[model samples]
Target: MTPISSLANPTIKHAAALLTQHRIRKKSGQTVLEGVHLIEAAIKQNFTIKQIIIGQSALSHPEVAGLIEQIAQSIILATDAVYKQIRSLGTGVDIMAIVEIPTPALGVITSDCLILDGLQDLGNIGTLLRTASAVGISTIISTTGTAHLWSPKCLRAGMGAHFSLAIFEQVDYEAILQKVKIPLYATSSHTDKVIYQHNLTQPIAWVLGHEGQGVSEIFLRTATAIALPQPNGQESLNVGVAGSVCFYEMLRQRQFAQH
Candidate 1:
């Protein structure tokens, strides 16, 4: 296909604006995926690819033959200048797509699970996901104030981990409580129960707190609060790191009992 001649092409202009504004994305009910890695991730997660825009120069420089072939959209070609102008990153990827956001499933947990309350760092959210996938946790329920799992940065930082598990985000505080019936162990700085002493073989949901503040008091009023001991001078750990630590301890204990 020859390079696009019209900078005013209705599709191109719309996509350009859509990339810059969150309102347009929400109104349109679409999320943009940049680069081959993210495009591939979205596909694996079964997100609908509404459209794809590829730069003329990128055609041969870094061929995403696989992604292009898999795309179900009418691939719109753009001039290198036009591509550069629309991309959010300085060194833009060869392609970008406006994808339909996958609505979070109402997951029913039959095994160990992780729950988050208002944890908002994209990097932290991603790290928690990667760790969750590694530690035999296949389900996560993210409640009020947590970073959106579908957001671009979280997806990228996750490195495709979203495609690996059933993650429910944007859940309400009360909704999460009603959904999880297993013994919920909420993380807190103040707890008499050391994590090691807790029984891990039982079905559980590890409720994690957000940055700056710990678990919400309402949840603590009902759920058991637990803490992991930190020997170093550091008083606190990143929620993602702390959550990962807690998860693996359960994994370790389970593994030990098996041996």
Candidate 2:
């Protein structure tokens, strides 16, 4: 097959737009997945892959070649120059796919879950997702002000954790407060209650908030506030670090209870 060498090609343009524009991704109900690992994760999770684009030079890579063999559908090949034009995350990514975004239905929170309230940093958003997934948190809800979960930077930072979790984005704060059946917990510097002392053995929803301003007042008012003990007297921890500590503590408590 002749490689698509032109940057002006419709397929190239579409992928570029999906990578750069949040509106385009939302309207199309699709997003671009870059690199071999993310595509592999998407396939493992049975996500619908609309199209695959491979750089011509990457065809010889064993992993890339192996992936190509596993995929039964026709793939578009692009010259190195063409692929470079559309690549978003930087160098060394020669494979990408246009996939339908998974819209997981949010039901009753019967297990550990996460609530991202106005968290704006893409890296923090991704880190929380990864940590939550690691600690076996199956569901995550992102309020309107949070960063886009499927954005290229977030997706890259997540390292395929997105595939393993049911993430609901752009949800209303009030809706979640009313809908979640489990206890809501938030971490705060002002709170006298420490995380280790809290009862985290039962099913609960962790509400993580903005990096600077912290959790929203509405959520804080509704949630049981717990603070991680800082002996050195640091002002506050990054949201990602704080959330990871909380998730693991919950996991540890549940594991101990199981014994």
Candidate 3:
């Protein structure tokens, strides 16, 4: 099969738009998965892959070739130049897939869940998602001001964690707070209560906020405020780092209690 060499090709343009524009992804209910790892994760989760595009040179790669063998339909080939047009910067990925975004319905918060309150950085958002999944947290909710979870940058940062968890985006904090039956905790540098002082074994909701602004006032006022206990005289920790610490603490407590 001849590789698609033109940037004006409809499939190339559509994939490019999906990668660069959140509005196109939202409207089309699809997102682009770059690299073999993300595509593998999507396949493992049984996500509907609409199309696959491979760079001509990547066809020789064992992993890429192996993936190609698994999916028998909807494959398209592109020249290296055309692939470069759609791939993310600094990434040498040669394969990508347009897959339908999973829309998981929010159910009862029976286990530990994470609430993202206005976190704007895609890297931070994605890191927290990866951390949450690593700690076995199954659900995550993002408030209106949070960055798009499925965006290319976020997805790349997440490294396929998006497929393993139930993610709710653009949620209303007030409404979601009402639905959460478990104890709610929020991180605050000003709080005297350190994270280790709290009992985290039980199901709870962790509210992590923006990098600069911190958690929203509603969360600070309503949720139990706790700090990470930085003794180095630092003003604060990165939101992703802070949240990961909290998530692991919860996991530790639960594991200890299980014995």
Best by TM-score: 2
TM-score of each: 0.87, 0.96, 0.95
User: Which 10 successive residues of model 3 have the least lDDT summed?
Assistant: 84-93
What are the RMSD figures for all models against the true structure?
2.5, 1.5, 1.6
Clashing pairs in 2: none
lDDT tens digits, residue span 18-84, model 1 = 7666567657767667788878877887877888888887776444777887777778889888788
Off by over 4 Å in 3: 89-91, 257-259
Writing each residue's lDDT as its tens digit, candidate 2 over 1-259 gives: 7899998989899999999999999999889999999999888998778899999998888889888877877699999998988898677859999988877766666677899999999999999999999989989999988888998889988999999999998888777877798889999887888998888878899999999998999988888999999999999999999999998888888886555
TM-score quality measure for candidate 3 = 0.95
Candidate-wise lDDT, in order: 0.78, 0.89, 0.89
> Which residues of candidate 1, in runs, are more than 4 Å off?
5-10, 13-20, 61-63, 90-92, 105-108, 256-258
Query: TM-score of predicted model 2?
Result: 0.96
Deviating ranges (above 4 Å) for candidate 2: 256-259
Clash pairs for candidate 3:
none
